[model samples]
Target: MAYDSIEDLLNNGGLKPGDVVSQRELMEKTGATLGAVREAIPRLEAEGLLITLPKRGLMVPSLDITFVRDAYQMRTMIEMTSVPFAIKHISKSVIAGWIDWHNSAIDHLDRGDEEVAQRLQRLDWDIHLQMVSAIGNALITNVYRVTSIKTRMVGQSRIRVTPANASRVIGEHLAFLNPLYAGDEVEATKALCQHIDNSLTLALGGTL
Candidate 1:
């Protein structure tokens, strides 16, 4: 596979942040040949996903202050700017589906369904991305995609699952949904910003 594909593979659950990885291990795990692994490494390195160090060839970089800061900042920018267009373009059915999924996630979390509750975290991501896409700006959508990938990588690599954090995450998403469904763009924007801020605080190793 190519580096872009490799990046997707890793993002799809192949590699974890801060994990020390080797060429051979990557080749085997990803089913890519040595050549493909070599090609992908440099690109991954450029993306801040990989870190080169003395005596330790390469490592999946840990979620550091820079990545965390940048991720939250870019995310906020995309979410806030996309709101006006999203309010205009996103169909009611799509909004309803998002609402249904989010409500299910809340129910699952309340019932202590760890597996579904954990997977529910992704709903927050999907809702925001869908909103951005509703704006119909290919340029902005694609740019936000890179931010999405980076954010996903950091969360997957570093964030941990805990009851308090999970509850807070659920609450944050729920906070955004009300204003969105009400078609109150201003309040929706505020909720989205608060959600990102909360996420930034949580990314500090879940201290929040």
Candidate 2:
């Protein structure tokens, strides 16, 4: 229940920066028990996603320059760390599966499906999270999970949703994947770095 509440915020964008929420409100919203919500608070606090107010209790963290920079820096570090492990350990089958999945998603988007938004959301997580997880390092995977909490928050709050933005995201991911698919280390390094550079720029208020 505790974890679900945080995921709700991540997946649904239920709360905004500066929004104040109480445990009781969370209970009403997510059907989580008071005890579960209580247990969850500390973890959220530890992630710096929320802060305690002396009189107001908990407040969602407002977006800030430092947080944006720190978030992207962490993302870059995670991507760099994962790349070698991913290159060394990611199986051919996994790479092919990812290509099929993403291409299928593009097809569905072209078909004007009602679930395109949710499907795209799933793809975003599948790609980003799976990229790190594929490295097969528990410590790296765990660290990435913590970083993901902030990235999701900032991304949902900042990234513009439009046809152009969508195309850019697809292009960048494919650029990164193509080299990896072909087992080209030098090209993969360039693509991976380019992806992070563009991503950091987008997170820094640049248009896609």
Candidate 3:
């Protein structure tokens, strides 16, 4: 939190697909001590944000098509099924907050920096999870919180945030929201399905 590992990557768009980074480089850039860098690496590694080589230094994890597929499979299962429960329990204010976060991500869609856009997309997903938590279903929310990191690890690879993809994602968010706003559980579930399926497809080819 103190250092600028993720923030640096987001701010300057320094990280890229298949880019490898060593402790020395991280230290130089982040101005973090070796211990701090060491501690941070594992956290990122756990999130699939970092990868290690046998004799090589730490690098960005490679994306795999299988990982993408499976991650989406799990995500779709969790999110789609959670829709009815979320619709029942989530509050209007929470839904509004999600919409605002989704719109903020859309505003950055044309930033021309793919990495920054991807970071925003990831943050948007984070906000969505928070919204889901408002459903007050501890079991479902806990499962989602655990699986989401895996999904992020794989999904982050394919999120390029072009106008088209950004628009599509934003639209899906609306699709999920409209029904929720109307208190229509069925429509909300349908929208959730489309969103999860589309996310999986997008990530399948672009991982790593």
Which candidate number has the best lDDT?
Answer: 1
Name the better of 2 and 3 by TM-score.
Answer: 2
- Residue by residue across 126-160, what tens digits does model 2's lDDT show? 66777788778778777777666666567674563
Ranking by lDDT: 1, 2, 3
Q: Give candidate 2 misplaced runs (Cα > 4 Å).
A: 111-114, 134-139, 160-164
Candidates' lDDT values, in order?
Answer: 0.71, 0.70, 0.66
Question: What does candidate 3's lDDT look like per residue over 1-208, in tens digits?
Answer: 5244654463334564467778878877777787888888776667456677767787765556676677667767767666766776777777777677667766566655466456656655665576567667787776666455545555554554555466676777788787887788888888778776766666666331
- Where in model 1 is the C-alpha error above 4 Å? 1-14, 31-46, 51-58, 151-164, 205-208
Ranking by TM-score: 2, 1, 3
Residue-level lDDT for 23 in candidate 2: 79
lDDT score, candidate 1: 0.71
Clashes of each: 0, 0, 1
Q: How far off is residue 205 in model 2, in Å?
A: 1.9
